[model samples]
Target: MDGIVVFGAGGRAGRAVTAEALRRGYGVTAVVRDPERYAELAAEGVSVVRGDVTDAGSVREVAGGAVGAVHAVSPFSGPEQGFASLDPDFFVKAADALLAGLASAGVRRLIAVGLFADLLGANGRPVMDDPAAFPPEIRPFALAHTAGLRRLREAGEGAVDWLMLTPGGGLEPDAPRTGRHRFGGERVPEGAPGLSYAELAVAVLDEIGTPSRHRTRVSVFVPREARVRRT
Candidate 1:
């Protein structure tokens, strides 16, 4: 897209996504809770706006005048690293504000950053369908993310063109970007490989430039065999 807004621009994945969007020559405005936290982004010539993710008015202000909005707002902290205590309703609320803001401003395309737990597994089952599959600590967040995707999918039909990028389990700071990734249907392959945040950013930018991949959710990953086995 020629012009786009990115929420959570200060976040880990958000930074990469914004950088990629800029690399593709798309004008970008990065929404952040504290603009100071992302000084580097500001120095990079990106338009940075201060706004709270939980506030509709604030989110709306930044969402205006952009052709595409990427919902990359994530509030997770490192130590806790779990979603059980996280408010599930906040996701829905954010969606409401985002959609409302888009509707009022005439912006129609939405690209969201979602968790892989909502994706279907090898047996045609959602990743959350097999709760026992992952560590107990992370299940709650996974389920909540799945719910968020459902809400986005439902709201997208009216006028917004939405696509959710469900990142694999092993996202990391150093994930590689070969600029090539595989797109699967509802069910992702077994052993769910990992993808670098940089690569995920590239994928999102690709979708932004190519509108045909709309109203869809796809997983980001690298094959297991290509992964380096660590000790």
Candidate 2:
């Protein structure tokens, strides 16, 4: 209620965001498909609940009274997972649900994590358009993500204000938090380094607390200079 509700709390980014929120003393409503699976996420200031990101009723029910909400849901985790069951409209459905549900629940701020493949390359084409840059097999997921972004744009800045933070490079799951990141425009930052989940969480919470950007997607990554220098 007083804090933020994270939709995919069981996943890597969700867990990182939850931890970062807790570290910052913000109460968290960690939403997962199965609460029992994320029992470890429940703590003094954290509430683990079962919710579906694609279902407006579920989003409304779980997001009630929250200051902000996060959309970190991903239907496909990796190449090993395959795209056989991946829904092309997964993100579109999520965007619709979050917009309608959060508005109904009175939550005004929404932060949705984005896929990098949709970012433009130097050649003025989406990174996904170049097989050498992004795997062609993953194009469906990229297109789905782009469609969701489009849906959000079409909705405009009505009741719910949303921002999508796309990682410019890979996400190093085990990397440490440097508490530093940079925001870029439509094109991926030239030499931006990969961001750790912790760093990404920091950016997410920062925006929630201060909210510099609005109703637009931005690229987030560690500056090459911000990378930890090895001895």
CA-only RMSD, every prediction: 3.5, 1.8
Top candidate (TM-score): 2
Error of 2 at 155 (Å): 0.8
Q: What is the C-alpha lDDT profile of model 1 across 1-231, one tens digit per residue?
A: 467889888887788889888888888999987887778888998998897666767767887778788888876654266555588776777777777777776788888888776777766777766756555566666666677777777775667788887776667788667676555556665677777788778778877777657777877676766555331
Best by lDDT: 2
lDDT by residue (55-144, candidate 2, tens digit) is 999999999988989998899888888899999999999999999999999999999999999999989999999999999998999999
* Residue-pair clashes per candidate: 1, 0
- What TM-score do all the candidates reach, one by one? 0.87, 0.96
